[model samples]
Target: MLMRPFWHRRTGRPAHPAAGAPGRPPRGVFPRMGTMTVLPPQIRQQPVERAFHGHVFSDPYEWMRDKDSPEVLAHLAAENEYAESATAHLAELRETIFGEIKDRTQETDLSVPSRRGGWWYFARTVEGGAHQVFCRVPAVSTGDVIADWTPPVVEPGTPMTGEQVLLDANAEAAEHEFYSLGSFDVSEDGELLAWAEDVTGDERFTLRVRDLTTGALLADEIPGTFYGSFLSPDARAVYYTVVDESWRPHQLRRHELGTPLAEDVVVHEETDPGLWLGAGLSADRRWIVVEAMCSEFSEQLIQPVADPSAPLQVVLPRTDRVLYEAEPLLLDGREQILLTHDHDAPNSRISLMDPADLGRPVAEVALRDVVPASDTVRVNGCAVTATHLVVSVRADTTLRVRLLPLAGLGTAAQADPVEPAFAEELYTASVSAAEHDAPVLRLSYTSFTTPPRVYDVFVAGATGDDAALPAEPLLRREATVLGGYDPADYAVERDWATAADGTRIPVSLVRRADLDPAAPAPVLQYAYGSYEHSTDPAFSVSRLSLLDRGVVWAVAHVRGGGELGRTWYEHGKKLHKTNTFTDYVAVTEHLAARPDVDERRILVMGGSAGGLLVGAVLNLAPERYCGALAAVPFVDPLTSILDPSLPLTALEWEEWGNPIEDAHVYRYMRDYSPYENVRALPYPPVLAVTSLNDTRVLYVEPAKWVAALREASTSGEPVLLRCEMAGGHGGASGRYSQWKDTAWEYAWVLDRMGLAGA
Candidate 1:
């Protein structure tokens, strides 16, 4: 989804006549603009010629790729200084927006507790705290009836009786400049805790073990490990993965307690550079699943938790263009595997397979179809329990959960689907958490206007006797909205935009209900058309500031996302990636045509792969928008994909075809690469946000992009780069710092939309 850099030299003629003659700006020259302290930073160009697919292309701002160079750092700092000076007048607006967000959000809040093992676990955030504190209380008894999900109403600063703090992120983060909790898991006995932390933003975490009984940390420390670590059922061994040179998780290792790091055994090693390896415990806790997968292909291996040193048994061999996930399940006195795969079904289907047949030396296993895939519905995943089977499916770009009786699973019997009832059509309801043996399922529901609500769905009859039984709602916990908030004050609607290919693109919009549709207003549209990640309609407290100010917020459910189904994603990836850009442009045009939206004040924002979306669209139709915000954008796909040494490049080849091997992919990528397509045109105001420590999408992308825009754009509109010196791809580590960043971005958007006073 994003890129890296390489070099060459060109003399005589410039790469693009529109980019101006490649040269350098005087170091000490600071041009003054009206009410601005200084002009934007002018980066010097070092010509780099790259020959690919029998075509030679010249890159001027390739010098920015040297992130460690003093000049590059100075240029980034200078750009930040210029950005601050350019938006100096919006200081009060930023503070006002920040205040509104702070006032509307509950400073001290506790999440709804979910029962796991013998404890009810939840996370609490205190006012002025940088991170959440994970806490749990011992369950009063092990009973079939679900306990109350509603958390006790405790004072802001008071602690609940019998509450034990599992992990205080604030305390852990106090010593590090940047702290990110990658994984936190408690042993089955609940005596030991294993957590991973990334001090830098590189994502390589350090695994640490803590003795919960003594509140003391163990001497075991694993450095340069990846995200999750699964503790053995016996709590004697921990399984973790480590990344390769290109940052792909390649090796799954097992570390025994009180053993040296050198003694750790390699449980599994993925030789394929494209596939990533990971391990996780099954919901039933009977098996440990090791998955090696790329974007299109996946292979799963399972080993019994009772034998930590046992050989892994393959569920199914990896097949090209076929992706499937296997989870262990217990059904009808047998060990079965619940497989959600898109082998023949485009949207995917759920199948049940016996573990005894999984060891057959065959290319594929004959599985019994449970939930057959349809053209309209996409089977997302399934949560299996001893009592019921919860299937999560997406239809019409909305999520819903279906509960099916697990009794007689091995027999050829079908049960009616138990769907959750909701008042809004464009809302999301999902099985948030469920114990493998518990009859109650923790469900989460939310919409564009409604805050998140947690509920315990009690299944009265999990047997065939009561097939029409309804889910009993035991307890509900609605998120606290500090300010006087009402769902009636806002409205959410779904509209369709006809793309150039005659495909209907879904658009979700939210705004104040009182706003007149006939009157023109600023519209902020966001989208991420990559990674099959769905941008569902979810409530946001900070978004209220924009809605209350008469700004309409919308999400363009463009192609390459899982919003609609797998077909939608297939039509917008690799060779068909251009559809993603055209679809977004079509959505922009559709919104502009609406009488309620101001065509001149349209703002586009996205990050990471979505950042690539905004960047590509900005180049495609610069005149359609007033401003664009690209946060950690993957704008240099050509360079990154061309070099396999870069992080995520090889792993992402399936998403964006392997350019190094295919001439077609190389040329196609070169055609739309944002940095390569920069021209001397009247571009709109653009803000590029990046993090210095971001390994996913290197900060060099936005850095070089901003420089190129400054050198090429004739629009006088400011092209600014804001680099977080000590942050990662997601930006700031602390909540307060993240809020401040949001406020700053909101201020920029408001000022551009002529709503600074609002």
Candidate 2:
């Protein structure tokens, strides 16, 4: 899991929510509307002045940073109670929404099995299970290897022969309130299994080994490890990373199977605090790649898996503003490195380098251009198999896959591209899984109105210009909608909204097909415009509750997202980051102007970096939305970016400029930092959700933000904060808890729109 460094710090004895009168509000009346069941929390102000770049600023709620303080805990508890009382009238609605979600989801379902190392691996969930059971079955020898792409049909509640349960997450989480599996890997020989788990909401995980044959745990345990860990090719050792004081993964260490924690050897130590380190095995399973990277640039080192003690070979040196990834491929019976780099190409291009020239400097290496950079296309990712090179690209704000032959490479003419066919224009399709040695490609497809579908495409080894092979449908799970549900009853469409600078921002809309165009419908708009992360249209069973009730759902494909291309992301990040907020506001205004949408009943929602988007938009255009929902929001960017002691702050300097070192960046951030820019104006109702153990975006950010909003906002509309005591950046560890959280949020939105009964 790649945690996004969005940007937060805290002070003061937090104020408790004021006690309510003796009587409660009417059955159907919302407390915040007029009949207040409880007074809003009054956070005490203990201003702390700080000088940065010769400018002075005050943070009144800085004392909230003391998580150990009893006062802080009491304040958080008080806020939770207040939020619950404020929305108590929506309890019935929340239950209804949760029921809808539970009814529509296929509770007892099995994922399509993917073969690896002579085993078909998959995860299955029981009807009432909170977690999935990771399992595998020995693969049988088949004459046609490509045909094995069709997964075995394991009926619900039935066990397959020779089935092996790798790790039952439900059992592991039975004793802990919050449980997360950081990483899990089986040894090449399939005798040993390595897994890391985080019992607390904190990101730190404990690594442990298990004997598959005996189903016994090893005494060797490594604590405070990061998310990813790799099993050595020979299964004698495991490579893992540990976080520095600021919670950045700065060291890669190798732990032998039977060795003590003190005896673990440091494989690589990253000196640059701004770059994070991660390790993984190559697709060929012959080499281990240790990569050091920031948002802008990356450097890779490769060591042969066969010789774990060998010195790492540098694939590329760090270059300013240049990013690239290396993939190992065997071309012409020799090892070659496929490089996807942005060297003189904004959209990036794929090149090949000789592995034999390991001692040569990157600049002196003979690089062969394989996939030329295109002005209209942006290459998202690529994978190399024995015979084909599969590339994932984005064009016209839509995802597409292209397969090219890699048999002859430099000497042979280029082959025709093979693209997977999709039924809808606004759907998403990508290579979900693939075996490096197999010709079968496991592709996944989903749209707003369709559940996820898996397909297997077999390449016939065609290298020349010819018609591409058709994909074979493997499996499609019909989501169990208890009351009766049909995708044909819904409609999904794409539209455009012109930004302030005349840039056309793409927007996807989903609603009931029978929705009346003349009637005003309350809309829920979502956007996540950061880190080049594309927000594709995907099916959500819970969303049916809103769509079925005439509520319109929309996604603003604003700049800063990778939907359109790399250029689109470039235009919305760094100095031009405000474009993301403006683009989202533009989309909101456009949607509000439509005859089918009620301008005063629109809601905006986002999380993480998207939380920053929603916060900034709320400040930029306060009157446009009826309500705003921000989850784990990064509202205090200037303060967080200035503090190098905070987790992920140093690594995030590339995304958000280093305000500590540059006065210009400091002033630029001050202009748009949501917390700093909050005004005493009439604002709409707002709800902020955060987690105490969130390492990426500190919970203090939202805590401070809500306090500031309550003090500054002129509008009497409610501003509430809900803090999850045992959750991390992603709230609620179990499926049931997550559904309940979603229901709570949806109920809030419905209540704010005055459609609680709907």
Candidate 3:
């Protein structure tokens, strides 16, 4: 859903403003306010006139886009200094919140182990360690598959009989200021490990291989690679993708061990600038699935893992804008490709097709429907094991997992699917890991009040219970909360907000159980109304700080997100994007009217595309909030989408419409773009956070928006920008540093809500 590939600017239909129309008078030129007061940074206006689609617009502060310039850097530093001075009184509050976050967290912990081949892989986080330690222990197996699949019980910080440390991330990241582990994949035989690291947070990684048995790294060092790199089954080569000049992963390459990097074969290269390329190994490890995808459509290519040099076979040529994921399956002594696709179904469905008919035209090939499309149920994904078909579906606005026996799959006698039961009405359950021969399915479950829990669902060799899944889920572990945290302390409920079009939007809220509804309390409203990414109700250790301080947190499931269904997403994108902003406004009004929420104390927050939502809604109804926080905001959508050279711009055309090629889209985008629509409104105090190295949404966006707000806002509230000098789309990298960032934001929001001393 994010964008870029190199393309020249295109102009379609042309529209222009009146000849005599003049831009806003030069503003934000005020001298230091009263001298004694700490003044915000005063950025010099360097107007750049841009002409596109017969429209000429003047962009002051465009010079901030030159990130390498000394003036821009100095201005950014000054902004940081001003922000620190303005909130200097909150220093104690920030430290207190940080302490609460650290105290409530289990400093030394271990993840639930999952069986892969003969080893049980897991990760450990030691006290005071900023990164995880990847380690594996020998997996013992019995004659029965179900019994053999059980994960061994290992205590935290304890050394096992035969435990091998794969790669200690703390040691690897010790030399870098910012560290991110991109790919950490282990070979099938457990002899080799392929991992990648990004030190600067730009997302381009360097891949390295390690010989686990010898406890030494191999000589293979490949740089400038993207994420999702994997090792071949035989360990002779590694498959990875590389990004182009525009930061789109466009090439899928195979690098053989001990060979020169130049000799690496190009397995597949995506010529379409909008499509991204990535590869993954199938569950059976029989085929390498290379997918070239965009938001609207995708094409999958399959290559036999037995032969690394084999030519790829197309599962289905990119046609009719169909989006599908095909997985190899074995049923009834025959191999078939199971596809969860949106060919004719909006919510999607599961179908079966013969492997031989993969390249045939849609009209020529026959596909048998296994799970028919339903308006109520959206089949999002599927995974196959040696015995069962696992499907993930969203219904009732909650994600659930289902299981179907593979005995008669793709036939008339196929068994009915059974869904496992969960206690909570609003929670997320998903398949975390699935092994080909394993008898158990690893699942991850969480809710607003409940901490994350890992479970193993046993389904193999069951005949007595055909109506329901045979065995009860075995709980492997639940995340540890150090400070006697209890789910009963909080309450969660879903309320409906009616939009202007009479659409009902769902609002999920969590507040302390003792908070009285008769007394209005400050509320923090959050949403990410783009990319179909749902902001589900999940537990957060740091959020407890706000809840304990009488702050209520709520999530608005707006139309642009996939919380409801595909139709909900379709109604809030491209030309219909304004629905996203209006929905947030509706939610704000609804919350303000509630007896439990204070009208003058609500603050808004979102990141990335959600940040755009925050900006737009603030402009629409600034009086509804006390302050706003936008992180790496895509506030300048019109300018970014017009220039295809920017990272991920071309790829974004599918989601936001091709504004460069369409005049209507250009005007529509320009009308509501936060930076373009800044007027003399009673805007609230705003905090914009960004990273200097983020390629997805450049820090320049918030920089420009901050300048425009200062110039146009009628309210004399402070506008602040906090830029991370060495971070990426995500601010700081280490766990400790991330905790501090969270504390800083919480402190700022609390100060705005008059709860800084709470």
Instruction: Report lDDT per candidate.
Output: 0.81, 0.81, 0.84
- Please, what are the lDDT tens digits per residue for candidate 1 over residues 1-758? 00001100000001111110123121111122227657777677779998877888788877788878998889889988988998888899889888888887887988877777777788889998979999988776523243333334444567778889999999989988889888898998999999999988878899999999999999999999987787888899888999888988899999998999999999999999888788888878888888888767678899898887799998877744457778887776777888888878999888888777775533456778888879999988787777787888998789999888887664567677788778798988888887776656888988999889887776756434344444466446788887678888778889999998799999999988877666677789999988777888788888888888878898999999889898888988999999999999999999989887877778899999888888899889988887889999999888888889888778889889988889998888888888889898777888999999898899999888888888889777788899898888889788888888899998888766766665
The predicted structure with the larger lDDT, 1 or 3, is 3
Q: For candidate 2, list the clashing residue pairs, or say none.
A: 10-62, 10-63, 11-61, 11-62, 11-63, 11-64, 12-63
Per-residue accuracy of model 3 over 698-754 as CA lDDT, tens digit each: 999999999999899887888889999989998889999999989989998877776
Most accurate candidate by lDDT: 3
lDDT value for model 3: 0.84
**What digit string (tens of lDDT, one per residue) describes model 2 on residues 1-758?**
01222232100001111111123242222335435679987789899987998999988999998988999999999899899988888889889999888877778888878887678889989987888999999887665454555567777789999999999999999999999888999887888889999987787999999999899998988889997897888888989999999999999999888877898989999989899898888777888888888867878788888787899987877754457787876787888888887887788888888887654656677888877898889887687776788888887777777888886565558676778767788877788776677667777888898877777777766323224444454453444455567778888888899998999999999988877676677789998898888888788878887776667899999998888878898898888899999999899889978877777777899998889988898899887888899999999988898898998889988888888888988888899999988889767899999988988888899999999888889887889999999989888788888999999999898777666766
In model 1, which regions exceed 4 Å deviation?
Answer: 1-34, 142-155, 359-364, 461-470
Error of 1 at 492 (Å): 0.8
| RMSD to true structure for each model, in Å | 7.8, 6.0, 8.1
Worst 10 residues of 3 by lDDT: 8-17
Could you estimate the TM-score for every candidate?
Answer: 0.93, 0.94, 0.94
Better of 1 and 3 by TM-score: 3
RMSD of candidate 3 to true structure, Å: 8.1
